[model samples]
Target: MFEQLGLIGCGLMGGSFALAMKKAGLVKRVVGYSKSPSTTDRARQLGVIDVEAPSALLAVAGADIVLVAVPVAATEATLKAIRHLVTPNMLIMDVGSTKADVVQAARRALRDQVGSFVPAHPITGREVSGVEHADAELYTGRQVILTPMDRTLPEQFAKAETVWNALGCRVSNMSPESHDAAFAAVSHLPHLLAFAMMNSITGQAEGDDFLSLAGPGFRDFTRIAASDPKVWRDILLSNREELLAQSRLFQQTLQNIEQAMQKGDTQALEDMITLASETRAHWRMGAQRTSKGR
Candidate 1:
């Protein structure tokens, strides 16, 4: 068990993590800090943290494990804030959606102490965000991607894996570049499409009327459009390169379908639809197998 967990951000992700650690008996104490004083105070009152820290450095003062749960844009500044107190044995991790930029931030901010930092991306969250919405079961049975740098300490890496595993997470390792690229296609690009789909509909004069007629399909497809704007904004920008590449590929496929429609080619349209339906069915089968621990 860790002696103390120094939590930065104190919002949904950080607060949930602290609660999970406490539930699993993985950490003895949690000291939390946030950009907003009220947030830190609320986290303490909610029992998400045992102590309130005034600054990031103070939060890390005596903690053996630290979680930097800030936005992708604030990662660099947050790491620099606590770098002075970072120790070789301390295991630091982040929950940012994108990994490449986060790894770069750690390298620049921590320098020789970078070995203590292990970049992590936990694939789970709710549409609502804040300390009040934090759930102890947030990471349970979810996938967590860890991207450790070459300089990362083996002992610290092992501890990081143990902590997440204790919380009931399925932990996997990947390079920062590969992690970012893969997520850009699976996660980031979908958020981008959701945002655009919402805008495209709402921009019309009959938008409200059209929304009234939306069925379960539309609701299911557009659920992610209601995600926190600022958080998604930072994520989309941080992994823009890979996201854009995926977007171009999506456009190519869309154009092919559109051309088939223009030519009134029923056979081509049916073929494309069949291909997509079969692909989605195959993916669902594989996903079910993985969920059963195959």
Candidate 2:
């Protein structure tokens, strides 16, 4: 077990990780820091942290495990703030959704200590955020992707894997670039689309009326649209390049369906619908099989 865990951010992700570690008996104490004093205080009051540090550097002073759970854009500044306190034995990781930007930030800020940094993205969260909503079971049965740099030490990586495994997380390894690209399509792009769809209707004159008439399909589709704007803004910007590529592909697909509708091609529309139905059915079957196996 880790003697101490220095958590930077102390929000939903960081708070949840600290709680999970404590619940699993993997960490003895947690020292947390955030840009806002109230957030740090709240974290400590909620038992998510044992101490509230005045700064990132102070939080990580004697802790060997540091979790940089700040926004994607704030990662560089957070890393720089504590780089001087980092040690060779320290195991540093982040909960940022995008990896390429985080890796770049680590390389620039951590310098020689970069080898101890293992960039990670936990594929689990809720529509709500903040320390108040943090849960110890957030990482249980969830997938966490670790993107280790070439300079990363094997033992450090193993320690990261061990901690995540102890928390009941299914861990997988991938390159930073691959992780960014894959998540852009599956995670980032979907959030963007949900936000866009909600805006499209809300910007209309009868938006309220339309929403009042919305059914379960609309409710389910727009659920993620209620996510924190600031968090998503950083995520979209960090993975902008990959998201833009995915956007273009989505637009092309939309145009193809639009053309089919405009031409009144009933057979073409039927074929498109049939293809999507089959693909979704197959996907559902595969997901069920995987879940059952797990």
Candidate 3:
């Protein structure tokens, strides 16, 4: 359990974290700060944070633990802003989607505080945003990745693991680069595709009919595209290289399907469809098994 907990960016993820920690009695106090005054006010009234600080630097000054639950693009600036307030004894971790940049920022700006900084990301979320949607179980049984290198101390990693485990997470260790590349493919690219698909069909001739006939499958496919514009735009820009690599793969696959269609190759089209169906099934089953097999 931690005596003092500080959080930056009190949005859905950050608020949810505070709720979960407090519910588990793992955090005595959660002091939160955000760029938006309205968000801080909401967090306080909703009991997601105990105290609202005027600034992030003041918010985390004496905290035993800190969680930066912001978009990936904001990680460096946020770390630099609060580096002076961090102590080597504290545990500083982030819930940013990308890790390489965050780890580098902490290493450079808060070199002495690196050991206390555990670069982390939880592979979980909802389409909705804001403190109002903060759920107590957002991270329950979710994969929380901790990407540490040889420069990291074992004791620091252990302490980080303790905090995440107490929050009801299944922790996994990985490198920052690997984490970014993997998520860029599995998470980022999908979001990009969904947005593109939605944009393409918005003004099409069948748009009206599509809207009226939209079913569960279509709705599900475009759900992630409905995420916060600012957040998704930042994520897309921040993780560009890895995401572009994944996008290239997607483009090639689409080209293959287009070529098959041009030739009226029903067998090849069938093969692609079958492969996609099987792949999706595997992942769906794997996710269910992970959540329930325990």
Candidates in order have lDDT scores of: 0.91, 0.90, 0.85
The C-alpha stretches of model 3 lying farther than 4 A from their native spots are 205-209, 285-294
- Model 1: weakest 10-residue lDDT segment is 285-294
Report the candidate with higher lDDT, 1 versus 2: 1
Q: Which clashing pairs does model 3 show?
A: none
What does the lDDT read for residue 255 in candidate 3?
A: 100
Per-model TM against the reference: 0.95, 0.95, 0.93
What candidate 1 gets wrong by more than 4 Å, as runs, is 285-294
State the local distance difference test value for candidate 3.
0.85
Candidate 2 global TM-score:
0.95
Ranking the candidates on TM-score from highest down gives 1, 2, 3
Residues 1-294, candidate 2, lDDT per residue (tens digit)?
799999999888999999999999998999999999999999999999999999999999999899999889999999999999998899999999999999999999999999989898988878888999999999898888888888887878889989988999877888889888988888899899999999999999999999999999988888888887878999999999999999999899889999999999999999998998898777741143121111
lDDT of 1: 0.91
Lowest lDDT sum, 10 consecutive residues, model 2, at: 285-294
- Between which residue pairs do clashes occur in model 1? none
Local error of candidate 1 at residue 101 (angstroms)? 0.5
